[model samples]
Target: MADKIPQKCPECGGSFTAKKLTTTCPHCGTKTELGIDGNARYAYVAPKPNQGKTFTATDLLNEFSAKHVSGPGMPDLMGVNKILKTVSINDVCPESGMTPLHWAIVNRNRAVFSLCLARGADASKRGTGEYEIAPIELAHREGLTDFVDRLVSHGASADDDMLRPIKEQRQVAAAATRERAAVVKETIARLTKEGKRAWYQEQVKHFEEILGIKSSVARGRGIRAFEKVPVKSLAEKNLGMEEWLIKLHDLAFEGGATLFCEKGLTVSSKIRLLLAPTKSVLDVVAVSNLLSPDEPGCERVDIGRQLEKLYVELPYRILECGRDGVLGDIRAMPDDLEGLAKRLLDICPHYGQTLQAGNGKPWEKVDDVTAVKNDLTESRGFFLTWD
Candidate 1:
């Protein structure tokens, strides 16, 4: 017969006899153990490591929360892996129905979230209750574009519904930028016309800063009038070219000063003629200086020679306008030509017609012609010469 020892239940403090190394308390179902000695006292028995133990979703959440709070960067990855072994990565907490991924997002813990993703957490799984949305949706709602991108790379659906908000936001921002640019132009024009030279210079610097354009002032001989270069008769001319010449003449009467000219089809001469009244020559010098020997247009040994081959070409390119010595009316044009073509057509439909009737291909077919047309229409001025 087995020896029976008198013992007390460690959990409930109930008297009992321990007939085996491990015995259960009949009173409270608590397990107790006794030594081989007949006089050995009963003690609470801890189950074997991981024996009959189930790691629930709640346990995983608590572990992650504790680690997230205690650590600086990420939760203890080993601890997370241990719990993940027993608990499904997609398991939802009983109370919140939020998976570990959802919890990571809630805590804004990207490290843990990425770990969960790497461990096969379902990014497409929608949680219950307040977070009844997929991980990507939550990421998007939180304005985590990188997170959304990652989720997409990991196979999360980038449906139109999920991306519409970002597209809409970008459109709104672009519209605001355009509006703000217009306001800046108007203020600069007003300041220039009011003879507020000090304010105008400040505004011009501000405009240059906003547009990411370098500030340059024409520094050569300042001629009060521009010499009219006679061109082919209208019948033999590209009407677009004729219109541009007409616009330059108009700008001359409106406070523009001819700075210099290089009278030829050379790049420097063309840039000079096109930006004649404006102050973008310094821009040319700056661009020429920035060029490297390996660059395409920098093959010419001299900086001045290189400036002639630099990006600006015949007819397509036009002067960039700003407050510094640019015509007051011209200063009202936006620094960039993006979407300006439509605005130009809205303001001056006849200009588009003239570009279409020009000797060259229609503006739409030409790469930069629409941009030039837009600039000319907005400033009611022209500085570019056609080849």
Candidate 2:
């Protein structure tokens, strides 16, 4: 009988060391002796740990409320989540058909709501009695904005009569419901960006078709504006060769650029077409300086030998354009200056770079074409060899 006796204390309602007929409550220093008719009442009771509840949810509501009476962040069963996982998680109040979800919504306890959700609590379950309200509707009425979003995102229907008016309410509406214009602006912005991408794609395709080669460098994004090819015919019958020599000398003297040239050529403009496939200044310059004029090399190299070899080596024989891809206007008599300049730039990338750069500013030294153009404009004859 003594071994089976409970050891709970009365004074502080704490456990005590039981011995003989006397025991002291360690918590409050209270002493008690067993009465003739032994009863454990509040003096001694064996703790039944982990005992499954024999009562209903309605009867447990008061205890539940007491446990969670503390404010937000400290949930009722927060520390006992694992224990709750072992219980009848779907229990509801008999009076209102309100489950733990409803209670969580009423308290706006997001932690508890998430826990209940994870444990198979139904958020969309309707309450009983005069009014049927879901957890989302309850939160909406309570003006719990975050709860409303969490509920909606987790499968709560905004179309429900109970949740719709709450969805329209300014204080509780979700981000999409509240700022409707943001959706439109976001869509418009996306479409606008896509449209620009498509336009640029088409432009790239057209550019490739015109030159029969692809260009990675975008039109407006390039370092320098695509300029006209400045080619001159160099037949012995004409003084074009002499004029070209004088221009090269002035380029070295005025603009601090040394340019070597091939003696002359009467073949078609296909020589310029060779540069269409390349955009690198180094690559274009290499092809332009094909046959070295130096013993080993000099600051400049002549491309006459390479051009002569290509004229015989390349199978295609039709003249694509005028000398150095100079597109002399067919309709414009013989000396159409405006027509010639306009047609000159509509050429291969290599031809354009070489023709423009050879006159004064070397393509590689075009660090700042805009600044160079400005300098040319300001100093005129001193910075530029020829127009």
Candidate 3:
């Protein structure tokens, strides 16, 4: 005996496992299981891969009646031909505010326009009133003479005097562009001149600070030295006082030292508990401190010792000046001051306080009290005479 094949119930498209199946679908309770000699029914079959690819002209006609517009390309043309078989051209795109006649006329497609007119498209079907200006106006502006001719032949108004002087309007636009360019050029020239003047003034000030001289002489010297010094040389390393202060007042700005004095000290008789630094004392301390460094094998040991010795000896000279209630005025020894300021800027850059070029029209970054005081006095344009 052979094993039996399972029967598929037609109602639910499901297989029945038993060899002798009942007449009803077990899942749906429909009479799908037929007896052996009952009425014959065909089995379900899947379609071929390209079975639904093509459309008939009647299909295109129905679709166009339903949808007002069709896209471009081979597939769209196939569908368009299908709709054309069943419907007239005028009835196809009525809802779109354009008939096939209007589309063919506007696009200057003479063959398409002929086909549409042969298919009973009305020549005088005007589009909806939503357009501010009609389609013919657009064709005129774009200089599409072919489309203009087609519209005129289709009974569109050719004598409409709605044209603007487009050439004159374009010339005016070109003139406006030239004016804007000139304004930009003027602004750029103005900025350049302003920058040059500001830089010149700053250089003049820098020279006076170094040479302890009048601005007029220093200004001329600064201009000459500015040309001589290479920008790379200035940036390579920190400046030393001898290289800075030894120049003539007409020389470019360089470096120097600060000569401290007793009057510059914060401590008094009542506040003697606090350390009061006099020029001579400070010089001795600087030399001694450099000679005895906390770190061993430090770089530039020999040069460091020499600088320390110079720092110690110079304070004594300033002490004499301090006796007259004046710390050697910074302006009097511009080169020395520049070197001192540079050195101080190198190490205790903030002089034990936070470094800030404070907010204002003119900016300054001096954390050391004495340096800050001198800067203020110099800025005031008065001889900083100590009482």
Every candidate's lDDT: 0.48, 0.39, 0.35
Question: How many angstroms is residue 384 displaced in model 2 relative to the true structure, after the best TM-score fit?
Answer: 69
In candidate 1, residue 286 scores what lDDT?
29
lDDT tens digits by residue: candidate 2, 1-387: 446355554344565445456555567764454433232122222212233554444443333443221222334454344335444556776775777777777766655678777877666777665226877777877877667766777788765654555456534334423333343334334333442454444543553454344434212211111112223432234555334434433333233221222212232222122212222222223323222222121111112222233224221121121123211112112233333223222212133333323443212212233333333343221111111
Candidate 2, position 8, lDDT? 55
* TM-score attained by model 2: 0.28
Query: Where in model 2 is the C-alpha error above 4 Å?
Result: 1-55, 59-64, 67-73, 76-86, 160-387
Tens-place lDDT digits, model 1, residues 165-211: 65665576566555544433443343234433454345444434433
Alpha-carbon shift of residue 330 in model 2 (angstroms): 88
Deviation (Å) of 127 in candidate 2: 2.5
Candidate 1: the clashing residue pairs are 274-383, 274-384
Over 4 Å off, model 3: 1-81, 92-95, 104-120, 129-138, 141-143, 160-387
> Candidate 1 or 3, higher lDDT?
1
List all candidate RMSDs to the true structure.
29.1, 33.7, 35.3
Q: What would the C-alpha RMSD of candidate 1 be, to one decimal place?
A: 29.1
Worst 10 residues of 1 by lDDT: 320-329
- Residue 352 of model 3: what lDDT? 17
